[model samples]
Target: MAVSRLDVFYRRLLLTKLFIGGWGKPEDLKRIFEFRKIIGDRERCKSLVPKDYPVYINKTEDLTDCQIHDGFFMSPLEHLVPGILPPEAVKARFQFIVPKKWQRNRPVCIHLAGTGDHFFWRRRTLMARPMIKEAGMASLLLENPYYGYRKPKDQRRSSLKNVSDLFVMGGALILESTVLLRWLERDGYWPLGMTGISMGGYMASLAVTNWPKPIPLIPCLSWSTASSVFTTGVLSKAVNWTELEKQYAINSVYEEEIIKLLEYCGADSFKMMPNLLKNVNSLEHLLGLSGDHEVSVSQYSKTQMEAEVDGGLQGYRAGEREQQLSSVNSKGTSLDTVTR
Candidate 1:
């Protein structure tokens, strides 16, 4: 298939609007260089997260149809990296939307943030509300570290300061997601799953691998390898290649030490698929996760399919709305540095 002229035009327009804030303070990369070993090694990364952590529920709002619960928890990244992160980014924030009356079979999905998604509104309004309305599904929306209330004060609008910020965001999300998953299980929200769009999808893929049990992993509009998106895609225009090149040329540390450490990170989705599938032990697990629901997996799938179809139709109609929201600014610094 050939690329559409409209798509090309969209990309070009996006390039011009996004990432006006170039590569931020070069000093920020120092922490990443120091901790490159931990970032690269899966086992070392896992060691940082505490198995049993508490999520403090700050407040709850009762809606006409559903109830919204807001909460916060200390991100494990603080323990690993110490004072590297801004104070705001250290405390992770989230919103959970649940049905007033629980369905016999409770279905909940954690929706991750896409590129330029700052707060909970995009996922809540576009995805969560519909899923809850149609299928009695609940949604847990996580605030990505480098976004929303957690975003660093000094960072430019949505554009992260340094290359290391991306690594930090990834690490923080992986551990923070597990905390939410365990909390859901404890609260008896069964048939849980994870899903995200674009950048969120890639982050979801990385988070799911660290999970011990099986769950439905749905990553929308994402690919196995991310290198091309940064190197060849229109998004590439957002990168501050001139500044990075200047630093790379002047500082032998980036060339000799930092470049070598980065060789350990890879984001190929295919590599994560097996780990995602390895723990599927039965039919119900196939439907979602292990659950004691009276409803059958086939029946749940039927409901989900219907919800998805309806959601897809709505998404298509709201395509322009979504594009405007995503084009707000380029907060995803990780996508830019992936090319290097």
Candidate 2:
């Protein structure tokens, strides 16, 4: 599609508002700095999670709107800091939607919730039915940790009090996706895929990179990297730089040290962008990476699985792990006899 001159001008104007102009409206800069902290310390950020995690499914019910499977699991972060979270917020819940006549051969798509996404709850039948009934595709929706069913009682709509809270949100989504992807694959579904609209799309990209095999990844209406989305996009205007600098005791938002820190954590750095935009089984040329590995490491984090030994690294064992897991049934020649 060709872009018009007016569209280009408008976009540039928006950019001006996010940057060169005064501190754009009043958004929380502390949160943005926390974002920077995550970028700078990739390994530490990933370490906040357990390398091997478990998920428990409570029940599955068939409703007039859709067949929803409800489940919950303890977050890897639960162990990182024991007993700080109340019991109610400790266990995370999720809903999985399947087509009315879900068959063995149907493909599964994990639909992630964007920030404050209400479409899934408000328009269940109208929003997801066509994808299932007409397209023969199954939908597995994961409610973000701090949003939807798992929202903490005290938290307001889609708002987090601390910067670590945001990183935890992203990490929790990645881990939960791991648990569900394992279940889907273990259940014998073939040609697996993942996708999301916006923030969901960014999280989906993170999940797929950690996944072993190259399945169809359709991150619709999204990009490969998250840096630009926050640093220079419309969202930046929402941040409160004056207060954020005050919180960190900094004088300038564009201080040389601060700029370096932000650049150091860019999504393109340390291979996050390139690996994400791989030309293998991913949708061709839709999204890309930026720089900076982002700190937020766990004892288990690393860009690739092979890079670390003690607790593992960024991506879930990438090539080595996928090879070990058999996609097809070894006992039976075809998928029919595969163990579920």
Candidate 3:
């Protein structure tokens, strides 16, 4: 009997998943550590920013215009501070819809948008707005970095520069959410919770993970293993793995050299590379490891997902590892480097 292409692919995927430990036990701390290191530094990534710290409302009356919306210009903390050029700068638009039964002092739910192709408008309308309104809560729709309004017009669509730029934008968005939450607290509006879909879900995970304080986070279609996305069969087409593998290999060879430059700087383990590189060729085989859906239905339960998000947040707060995941500045300084 002849083997079909689908059969070959499934076999390869199973092996790759086993090698990468994608479907392994959750309590495997070693796998968790390896996974985190592969993603570089989540904190150093870019995200959204508010135009103003206070986010002043022009008129109290305008709040009554349930359908009114506006954009505000704000830079993430890294961008605002001099001597730091972390991957990208984030400028986000604030979108809101006032519900008919709006209470003046009700808590607000902020929805962070997801990645690829577009921004958070559809998510805001379909998910965030409806949920917020149903709960009698106000809502704010935050655009992800390198998405919707934040994407540069001159850049080619889905290019490496565009993708890299979005990573930076993601970091900025995290910081922006933190600042916005603080601002809202000052204004007497409690941040009830946050939710995201797809890429937005990724950002929400990072936000809760990196946030200094505990915030209620609900990330739909979330995955704890980012390496799985790059190394798995499903997202192989999404990112140019062939090119990325080359980059990862180059970075691996220079890891020691790079570390020597920042002796005092914090760094994560370097074990994630070998698996990532080894599995690069087997990505197509791993498709059957998980389903076609973005969400990991078989591997992670709802409780498990929530716990992982919480664990990521705790990791950030504890500062168990260094913040600099990659070189963000052209000067060869790591993103986490603090210069006086």
Candidate 4:
């Protein structure tokens, strides 16, 4: 089906202005790279979020269909980043909307802010209010760092000053989401889930991945990764690519060191063939292939695999490392299989 003209127009309109400034300070990204090892591992990432933190509820308003509860907690990033963060961005604010009448399931979904979504107004009026009235579902609208009440005074609109700012926002949200999820669980909220639009959606996905329990995740207008958005999506127009390219060409550290680190850490997707092959058997199950039609990477297509490894044996050997870690299967998959 073809996309409607109105859809095209609105998407363009929404993505018009973003990343106004050039990649602010190349060194800023190095800060993000430092946390890569921890963030890449679920257990390590969860360790960053404190198990105990006080959430101070400041205000409450009784609505016809729901009650709006406002509260905030000190951002965990404050201690992590120390002097790097602006004062205003330290406090994580949120709006919790609970239905007047509780449903039997008592489901509450966390809503994360998307690009240009500065405050709770858009999510509250559009999602939270409607959800509660219709299904008696509750909502917790999280104010992303460098957005809304947490936005730095020096930052202009929602355009983050640095690339690291985006990473920091995601990290903060992941930690904060865990805190909220735990709080909700303690308060007797069952069947918790998370949802967000665009960038918010991506953040929600990341947050959900770190969660130990099974929960519903709705990532609207997002993909498994943000690379496609920056490279080819409508949002690409908003980036200062000329500046990025110019800096990449001139900066030896960014061009050389970053590339080396990414590949060394197995973060480079192109160099992930070994990891891909390790899970190749799972593909058979995914494809619903029977025992009679069993297929291995080599047996499936020798030509395609050979073509991918241009330099023959040396190319295949390069990916093999003694310290490489194997991927763990998700509990959900095992549970589903057992039920079946």
Q: Which candidate number maximizes TM-score?
A: 4
Model 3 quality (TM-score): 0.54
Model 4 C-alpha lDDT versus the unseen true structure: 0.70
Q: What would the per-residue lDDT of candidate 3 be over residues 1-340, giving only the tens digit for each residue?
A: 3555764574454322111211112122222223234233444422333324645333222433255355454555454433122233344567665455655556777777654536545765586566545676777777655456665554334232322243344446666776667666666776556777766676777766655556788888766534334333343334443443344355542243433433432533333333444453355356545444424543343446446656666676444232222222222322220110
Alpha carbon deviation, residue 7, candidate 4 (Å): 7.7
Candidates by TM-score, descending order:
4, 1, 2, 3
Model 3's alpha-carbon lDDT is 0.48
Error of 1 at 80 (Å): 1.2
Q: Which residue runs of candidate 3 sit more than 4 Å off their true CA positions?
A: 1-65, 78-90, 103-105, 158-166, 245-254, 257-340
Q: Lowest summed lDDT over 10 consecutive residues: which window, candidate 4?
A: 331-340
Per-residue lDDT, model 1, residue 290, is 43
Compute the lDDT of residue 164 as modeled in candidate 1: 64
Worst 10 residues of 2 by lDDT: 331-340
* Candidates 2 and 3, the one with greater lDDT: 2
Better of 1 and 2 by TM-score: 1
Ten residues in a row with the worst lDDT in model 3? 15-24
Return the lDDT, model 1, position 127.
92
- Residue-wise C-alpha lDDT for candidate 2, range 1-340, written one tens digit per residue: 3555654564555422222222222233333344435423535444444444567778988876467787778865456534433354567676677776765576888877775584356324544566776777777777776676667676555554444355456655665676777778777776678888777877787776666567677776677555433434444444344444454443444343333433322343335534633432233223332233222222113334324332333443452243223211111111010000
lDDT of 1 by residue, 233-326 (tens): 6455666666665665666665455445444356644344344333334556555644446255555555664566557656654743543343
